[model samples]
Target: MTYVSVQTQIYSPQGWDLSDIYKSFDEPKFEQDLTGLQQKVAEFQHHYRGQVSQLTPEEMARCLQQLEVLSEQYSYLDTFANLVFCANTRSSEAKQFFNDTKLALTRIYNQLLFFNLELQDLDTTQFDELQASSALQQYNHYLNRIAQFRPHRLPEEAERTRNRDMLTGRFAFVQLYSVHRGEQDYEPVATPDDKQVETPAQLEALLFHSDGDVRYEAYCSLHQEMERHNGLYGFILNAICQDHRIESQMRGYPSTFHKQLLAADVPESVFRLIMDGVSDRIDLFQRYYQLKGQAIGQKIRTCDLNTPWTADDPLLKLDYKTGVQTLLNALKPFDVFYANRASDFFSKRWVDTKVRPGKASGVFSFPTFAKHSYLSLCYTEDYHSLFTLAHQVGRGLQFSRTRDRQTYFNTQPPLLLREVASIFNKLLLFDYLLKEAADDPLRKQAVLTRMLEDQFNLLFYQSTISRLELALHERAAQGSFDHSFVNEQWLEFYRQLCGDAVEVLPEHQYDWAGMSHIFTQPFSSYQYAAASIVSLACYQQYQAVGKDFIPSYFDFLAAGSSMNPVEALRQTVGVDLEDPATVNGAFYYVEGLIDQLQAML
Candidate 1:
């Protein structure tokens, strides 16, 4: 079940093809689509405004069909504008055009939201009758999900006013943070030989450099900028958290974290189970860090987490082509369809792999919804970027296929479900690399080390952050929130999770303001951690059953929204997330990797 190498390793920097989305911003078709969108909005408001609740099932079905089409149109326009602007944040035209496009789209959204607003207002008898209608068979799950949020829906006037204010409220701060940080010049204190100043992604790449000095310099430079603007970022964090608190209070949610769990479509019981299960076994994490610290004769500080512990090798410096080949080969064991789909991403220019100025620092899978997904990464000649490519492509492949098979309404799942493909891909690739590493000790050590590091990051780091987020939100809910309070909570969580082997100080406390999740996106960290743990359980199942599990895995992914995630996992992997034992599965997986690394060392 191994793939033949597509070609020998080759190196070349290539850009993604945006033509599949649009030729350019000035393309006539984009303008025509925009005009059509305006007309459709007006028509919907004209026809379905007051009588939405009384529409026949057949007419409701027609409206649903029309809504899907309009959604696809909005997806295209929004994705295109975002991709264009992210490619060059410095471009004045791009900046202005992106802002304008967002405004237009928002207006359309406000105009058409009345349909769903009224639709969701249907009483139980009305909703039951509508659900029993044959025409709504395909939209059953979507409508049911909309109904599920009945408890959280605000009054129309309150919601509309909040929505109107949000454009200039939280979003304004988010945009300011992005542009303000993006516009700063990174003057590398260590690498003076380089011709031009490096982007944040490039400097981050250096943090993984084999040289300790380079890693230290990059780490210091990154925090210096972050610390310089800590107050503004802290203010943004406070404002966002306060706003979320107010919403939760108005919605009758017990806590902000409770609201987050609902949004993720998971029960609060499972969330607490996962968080507690991880923290209860922090002893293993502490032991791993302690032994590693002893081996390297250095304390495992937060800054040094990304630094390479073992000796450097040529395998670490994989050019983009070789990295692509590795990822393609790694995915082969899944089956030809899965592997070929991934390979096509490389062949079809679906990835933007170059690290250039003004491009965003992180990696992401652009959600084009109906058309296809595109990947963006600031790749350096390192396997970190390669793993990132594999991760993003995994998500892209899933999104592209899911959209093709699903209605527009069901194309995107909750955060937990959406992350499954990407995390599972990385786990598969890691297993493949581990098996391949048997031929070389250095490679084996590096792969094992990387796996352990991922456990720290995905499991421990995320869990700690999520726990701290709970405290932050709760304190804000009680009206005792402040910048100093934020710092104290952060450092306390750091102490709890990092163990005695790692140092935590006041300096590390302020970095919470820099984390985009707690600031811009509240309570999303636990989902990332959950995805990692669930993927580990999934991979372990594959190890137990061999290739027979592939069909079930594929079926689980293809289930789309037909099955709830809890049911999907129960059917496919035989693990119940509500049970605390699932975290033990992740623990078992990591412990085995730790034993191997210790034996090698």
Candidate 2:
């Protein structure tokens, strides 16, 4: 049987037009926003910069209010470009608008560099007086955040140069990789009936193909193709590491990864728990692999890992409209404010759900706050796709609240806090599906097993990878970027974690190639594991408290980057980051789920 490549172009359905974000780039409002933002940035510099340190409390308050307005305007315009390009990445006009807008914003931002620098220099008496003022007290979180960074504050020109260089150099490696070394030749694999499957997506589906030979052939073939680019991938990896280590030294950071954790207010022990906890639980993964092999009556191969748990015939998939409706029905537990926002998001085309050729794989929701959250993904009606939708929508809700409550400087929320909303949505969907499938023993077992497997992937498998990321940076900090030694260390880590049941394919030892984090953002992969653990604790809170939990959850969303991550979690969901129990609680929850799945089997 020939399996078609899952092109996302076929998923579009009517009533999902994205013009609600903005009619088109030609709209008069787009031009107005652009011109208005440029003026605001110029005015801010002219009015506030030289005098910000000496300003009275009232004057400082007024400046912040103006800054907030300017932030909202920029978000609205940027969101419009984001929504447009996400809808159709191939649109040259949309792409050009984004480029033009970004360059303009950068010019405007260069003028606002004095805001933080001047504030850091404020006299202690003046700063304390401002903090005591009613108008600024609400922004205490924001004030505290800036004060914390005073130690790292550099001379304005030097800091500005470093920031600009980072974007132009270290950050550009991933973009270069995407351009030069992306997917290549199709080299189709033959099936038992003598047909071919070309794309990786097509090859993926064959993991469930009835013929074992077909699954094994596609597995080896896919990895073989990826192996051809090893040298190129290693070059990219080396460049990224060298850049990070050099910057960390210049910035006076103890370690490269330490810089990332400090910026997010995360502790090293929090990461260590995830890494070590996952390593300790490899036996469970071994059991899972053994059981999977037994169920399929064949040894598990890399490609065969993704096959469906059941042998049922594939169902006819719904188009995007029907998919949105299905998602809406699943999310009915939230209040009308939440539900209506989600409804508008789908109807207004906040999500670019169709898969177009050359569009990036995987899904991401860009949350600009105040204006809109844009989701980009190659959609399908698969169960996994639904989970992806849930993830994005959850992020949208958090963004919605933050935009309403915080200013632009505080908009990002810490990455540590940001992942909670997205992961919470995944948990919500997972719980709902588990309950819905409770009646059917086999289907329940399959769905729950898959859900647990996903948890393991995020909470365990990714945690191991996160450790390798941290170790790589530490070694690099000491001036060692030995590619051979690093690869061998990675293999050792995986071998210890995976145990005897699973074989690490020889070529697959270069697993680090697939990690986009290493090339793009250093030491950021651990956030997945950190957030996964925190999300589980938050999920339990939701279960225990029900509707009463909504207010606290919303408060968490609204906190943005204003508070340290540990303080934010404690304030929002009552999870104490320093306590080993919080991390251990996450593993215990997954272990319970695994035990439940095993009982069903």
Candidate 3:
């Protein structure tokens, strides 16, 4: 059998032709970027550093405009190089180039470090005076964000010292932790068919196999393999926890996660609601799993939980082109502008969809304004993969529409609102599949089963992750950073959620080891649970208003980070996040879906 190289097909469609972001790594534009950034940084230092408070609003506006332009160019270079490196980590040339570019960007960026610190010192009278200027008024949101840092702002020399210390001291510990995890090799088990596949993805595929013996062995062997490095992993966890504790105290945060929620503009109460709501709804998710167990003809265990409800049809091959087309059709109901952007995404090669070695495991669309608005799936052509495509594109579309209106500083919305568009895409696809599933009832039920399981994974598993993060931070505050303790905490929660419906074996307990998100973004998982609820409400509006809902939806997409999440969402969807009703409505919808699924059963 000839092995087809999926690597060649992973390139962006039009490749460099679509954007000047990088015509080629060898292009003179990169050098131009280096020179241009240096000039901009010098100009920024001259304009803002110690002189910002004295400048008129008009001057500040000009400074911010220049900064925006510089940021766009700088971001394009960084985003493109990062994308290239993401596609192939083995490409030393790309890796080295990215490192060089990043170092250069950081050097340039450090000059503007005083921008926020100085802005924070500006009095309300100065801010009100600045707001009166037409050019500066567009950036009120950005200005307000900087102003909020007043309490945390340190003196200029101290800030620089802290930055230098972080570079040399803080990151070094994280790197050691990463190197230890990277070197820990968990040996793979032999499959029932006697094929050897060693990677995490392949191992996951086996654990989800229809064959119970195969799944059990893969699950047990994998966890047993992980147990060998428990001590080292424990050290890594403690180090990470300690890192957060030190920073939180220095930043004057109440706890480690306090800063994250404050950054997201969400309250701790809202975070608690996500955990409580999902916990109460565990029965609904458990029932779905039990139904999946019946469909797969297996004794449901943590290991066997991933078995496909609908068996693969030998005659059917889900190709890349077909997958893209399915997403196109499912998303067709949106407005013409939205549809056009989606079409451009595929036809212009705006999406990077093929899976390959050294690539990131999960799908996400980056919201860069100048480059690819959304970098999407490493497509596997599986059913779940299709939904991922839809979901990520939804996020990209939101960015594409909104980027034109919002300046760079305002584009990074709170994480809570950031997930709204992505989850909406998922709900849209789920609704479509449930309606148009192949005419056989069993087949339809099978599709629903898959969708429901996917929901549970997002709602329950991810919420569990969020809860674990919450607890981890609490421990970090107490100066306790034990990995084994964290693992035990996870297992206890797993048992609580699964109840007696599924058995989580001791060997299966190291499941947290594989979570890439925990290391990348702290306390980020709960947003998914909130997003699910928000999307359900948004979908309800879509059902009620029909296509008439398109404009406000577009408006929401276009708003970007212009307003606070709650205010922005209210401006678009007219819902209040602080209200218990808004969250309860989401739980109620999940309960209702479970009722529908149960009746079908």
Candidate 4:
């Protein structure tokens, strides 16, 4: 089996232009906005404080509109500072500006905190009347979302104290972890031609290197560096977990997971069902690994899990331009609007694809309420990089639509639905590749293998991490634990997930320390798994309905947080996250792919 790389003039990817947001921290507009936001917050506090419940429906609508404007102003400042810092984590100027912006926002948030508390305390009749009022119809969904948090609402003073404390608590530690990780360097992989892999994204790219030895060395290099700061990373994660647990207890939430569920407006039973469904499908995950091992003619190891099955063949590398074109072409057939939205990310330079010193690792599409979203990734010129671009572009496109269609309050989607567009784009790319292969058996097999491996990763690997997080929170609830405890728990979960299909290397225990989500966004892994399931179901619908599915899919992305995620899914894609059939169907789809791969073998 052989494949041709996408041929184009190879050019170094460009950094995103932040000028659209603000030319720099020194920009007059940036400073003006910062001052303007503080003034807005103060005005809002003065006008709405302690009077939210007493306002007529018309007045309430006006207050809500004012709050939305204030939020957009604050997010604009915060997003700029954070994006600049992310582009250069080592810059003291950037870090200081980011911290300063956060401090200012924190103060503003404290002043505005009373508004939400007051609204949460609104009497039922008034709240219902406001929802029914013509003037407040646009904000009815926003009001309902706030109402859901009433039971968890702390006293005004307590909530204000907590908001202020987060600057030095959870948020501070997360920033530390991000900075520390950005600074660590990994030993160069000699087998990979003496390449120095500094950023985590570079090291991760090496995991998919065609050479098994290169993959192993890269894996060791990553974990060894993480192991060096195991204590620090562990402490950060523990502190985060402890913080969440404490907050949950104080808020009268039953558990940390329960709090996450409430924030997503998802039921605990739904999350549990997804977790249990993935757990029950461990055999399918193991089978895929075993098949990969057989295909490569060697027993799989933790490092080799990402190794290309066609190890002896030269890897297919696509330049940034070609990658963008490939994604555009794939998406054009589905919907021109989506394709055009994705193209804007590249043509408009909204993506930072350059790998350089002090830049953060990992890929992300960050959407701003006041401006277009920005994406960042270390593009390595491989198929993986191409797919990652599609994934992030999917997110950018989804958010772009929401920003255009929904208000600032409804712009961000729930965690469970957040990954749907991204995963759906990946599937679209997969189908395009498979179609391009046509009658070429080897090409079809390669595409099938990559898609299957990704599914296994999203479903099983992510679920395993989610389980480890659950265990960590439970331990944190019991008492204090150190880095060693985290390492042990990670190893246990890894072994349980891998079974005998792959050898669990010693360094694998420290792998969890390298995962940013565990430190920054706990329980987010479950969302990845849940989104994968929902995405597969959506993909199946797309396959069944062809072009008819495109509009509804777009609607799903545009829905944002305006409605319950469960209802949104049911309405847009007809996917019911609570249905066992949906979970089973996703697994069955994976099984069919596996069978196809096995037949090819």
Candidate 5:
């Protein structure tokens, strides 16, 4: 609990007020709501369990309307459990409550799982009749989505069995990793003096610090800690990937990736297209790294990929107040709606930015079914944190707006578009910075360098992760992938990505072991690459169309999961996910960025 941030000359860091979720976890209403939820689930099961297929369209719509209400309550309880646990990961009470709530949700969800299965079970003529009904006017998208899963539906008992097994199975391992991440503290890098860090987030901050020795020491220490636990992390990753592979096989999917593509409502063809696109255009990045070596006065290593290329870059340490204001000003050019909604984030305590002890490691915005979102991130005084704040603000705005208008089932935007809105806002901020620093060559160069680094992270780095995941999953389907095999594949991805422009460290092979997402969600990292493509196109469209792009973009965000990603992107950004040219266009855009940076240099 050391290093509690205090008020500085500019502003103070603060935590989000959880009052909007509940006054306190122990509030009487918390218990009352849990009890009420139990009763409602019982009533719903009694009313709708086996009768879903027999109901008329009006009855079915009414049932769904009621189910949405129940879902909101479930969402609130789950969100509360998660947020409380994140703030104090060692809290036994929070742990127990979150686990108990998850069990309860699974049970209730099993009861309602029949709703979609039964609707999907209807014969085609009757299903068509249901879709044709006026009562289903607003529920068409939800019904159509349920229909999409019809071919993948398993026997009811198997689905039920899997639901019950999740509590003690793969999901338990996720918590195991969380426990490890939360309790494990790190020794910070020495700036001629060694210091222990209070949070892993602070330890990670060193990797992007202005000191090379500090970055190296911290990188070694952090990776060594995770390396020591490689067996446990490997087990977690293997078990999760195996479960996914087995489930996909049982669900009649061709491969493990087919399932994730299904969840994203995208096709395998589109994923491949984007992957090949990014892979083909990695030369600019190779050149960028060469430029990095020139700027930093040394040959770049894998660890040094994170170091800033230019030392003369302007170091703008934006505090909390200034950061929020900066986001609003940058967003104002795109649309006032985006700017104003982001402003609400500060006025309403919707963000948790205080870098304190026992908080989560990374940044993410939690979207609630209650039509509001909460952002949690470890804020530092750097461009990375500033842009991340802006990033989550984009997600917060999307979730709040989507939930306000769409039904609970349809409120979540597809993963592909979810990253789009966040990254689009990020590009806007970058544009603003470049414009602001036009008079200063060094500042603009720094901005370009930073932007290039981001492109590398999203396009090259994430795409490599995706490639490793695919290779690992394919290999895992054959048998268990051990520590050696995993490490070798990890190193291969690094080499494949950077080619020979940067040196590789053997210790860096353990890097994949530390990525929590690959354990929790394999095959999902590619979505960042996919979304980056859509974002580049969106930004380019914004430039060409000017203010006229706002309404289209707004409508795109508001669409949520109502349409496929390809359709949405085509309509809004005029980019087709299936087209090879669309992929080539994104690479060309990155090349243009390198052109700008090279000219400036």
Candidate 6:
């Protein structure tokens, strides 16, 4: 089961082929596209810079079409640079190329700032006329979304300055944190034969080790390294919050979180409702942890949260090919087309699963509107890896559908809806695994425990982090704070969530510094909690309606940003986020799972 032994096997993990994006960074086509994008941006600015307010509906449609084309070209270059850099963050060449591309794209974005600024200048009657026109129907969603920012829009020069400043300001700090994290080598776990963990992914995998001491050491090693750089991490986080607060005030947002809500196209009340719902269910979350501790015959410590249910539990292992087949088989029974769409990621070599040095930690599906999205993973050939693959493939499928059905302007879904498909896929995979282990009590129990752990991670854990983020923002508004302040706030939130069910270790304070999302995507963790609730609700509908639910589910995925997330969920799945019962229903599903787990005990 050693990583090295697994690597030596015949079916060694595969890395994705970037040939579809570009054969190489310096390829002729890449250079041509770079130059072509610059030319197009110039032409676009020249033609439509000041004419948006005067354009007729047909002309407005034409302008948007041109902008879409420009966006596709820009995405191609930008996505390529990012994918390359993420693959090997330690590569100096990759870093330089990524920064260079960002600079070029920022300049282009600055050049085109006038388009939106001028659009915001249109009189209400003119704007209403354009929206009511048939010719501009396709861009109705895009136009409305842009209009939502009208009150917050700055002057053209100010907007351009903000765009350019981001490269050196907030964006630089984010990059620094990513590189600093990716380049670290954690101290080896002694009980685990002194194996050196080179990346965060490897250290994370160790948390699931059967040996309790090994898990604890790995956890300490991770937090200790993070604590070592707490000062830098704290500074980056503070700067990001300050920047957000300053910009929010200048834009006249009612609150710091207002801008994020507007971007998500979600109402503040909906977010608060979801957060409150999860907060009310902390007892259920803690009860599950207590049950987990009983099953494992020990008090659950923070490090042991992901540990195996028993020392002798049969660890579910699957090679990459078998894992793919398992996922495809589970998906095929749900929908042949869905299975085939996921299969394309494998058959087309669009997935990178190799665990290698310098590769980015964790898994993500990098998306591009102009091309098929690519998935990255550090697969370890375990059930966790299989589930990770399923989660990411779900993202790939959702993006695939969006790319097929929506225009570039509407391709990216809001953050709240982004995880629906992925979480649904995990739920489906969980059911399939549980069914496969029906005859073996231990195996079935293992599967059930894994699902419960995932639920808590998504629902309770993310909710806690989201609350901590809000607290950090609130504190930042009052004055500046360092890593010690962050630690105290995180510990407080952690204690509130876990209660007496699990021990909150001192090292847990440093855990906040390791969450990339807090720094990279502020105020986003609640979306995971909210999406989990929505996904569980979707799963309940699927179970009740059986195959009849497929069409609407597909429609939900394909809706993209064309519709509001709340409206889309209500229309497609009959789940209303505005209703408290929706959240209650999702937790009831969790309660059923806990009841089943209790019976097994």
**Whose lDDT is greatest here?**
6
lDDT of each residue in 196-246, candidate 5, tens digit only: 553566667667766777778777888887788888888888888888888
lDDT of 3 at 142: 81
Residue 591 in candidate 4, Cα distance off native in Å: 0.3
Task: Write down the TM-score for model 4.
Answer: 0.96
Model 3: colliding residue pairs: 13-349
- Model 6, TM vs. native: 0.96
Give the local distance difference test score of model 4: 0.85
Per-candidate Cα RMSD to the true structure, in Å, reads 2.6, 5.5, 4.9, 3.5, 3.9, 3.9
Error of 4 at 230 (Å): 0.9
lDDT of 4 by residue, 1-601 (tens): 1212322233568898988888988888988888888887887788777777779988887787888888887887888898989999999998999999889888888888898888888888877888899998778778888888989999989998899899999989999999998887777666445555655677778888888777888888888988899998888888999999999999999889888878777888888999999989899988989988888899999998878778543335677777778888898778766676677777678999987878987788778885788999888878888888888888888888888789888887887777898998999999999999878877788788889888888999888998898899999899888999989998999899989899999999999987888887888888888899999999999999999988888889889988888899999889999999999999999999999889888
Off-target runs (Cα >4 Å) in candidate 4 are 1-10, 191-196, 312-315
Per residue, candidate 2 scores C-alpha lDDT tens digits across 456-547 of 67766677777787777777666656557557777887777667656676756666665666676666667777888889998888889898
lDDT of 6 by residue, 333-383 (tens): 788778877877876778888887788766777888857889998887677
**lDDT winner, 2 or 4:** 4
When sorted by lDDT, best at the front, the candidate numbers are: 6, 4, 5, 1, 3, 2
* Candidate lDDT (C-alpha), each: 0.77, 0.69, 0.70, 0.85, 0.80, 0.86
Model 6 ranges off by over 4 Å: 1-10, 190-196
Q: Model 1, 283-302: lDDT tens per residue? A: 87888888777876788776
lDDT of 3: 0.70
TM-score of each: 0.94, 0.87, 0.89, 0.96, 0.95, 0.96
TM-score winner between 3 and 5, please give it. 5
State the displacement of the C-alpha of residue 222, model 4, in Å, after optimal TM-score superposition.
Answer: 0.5
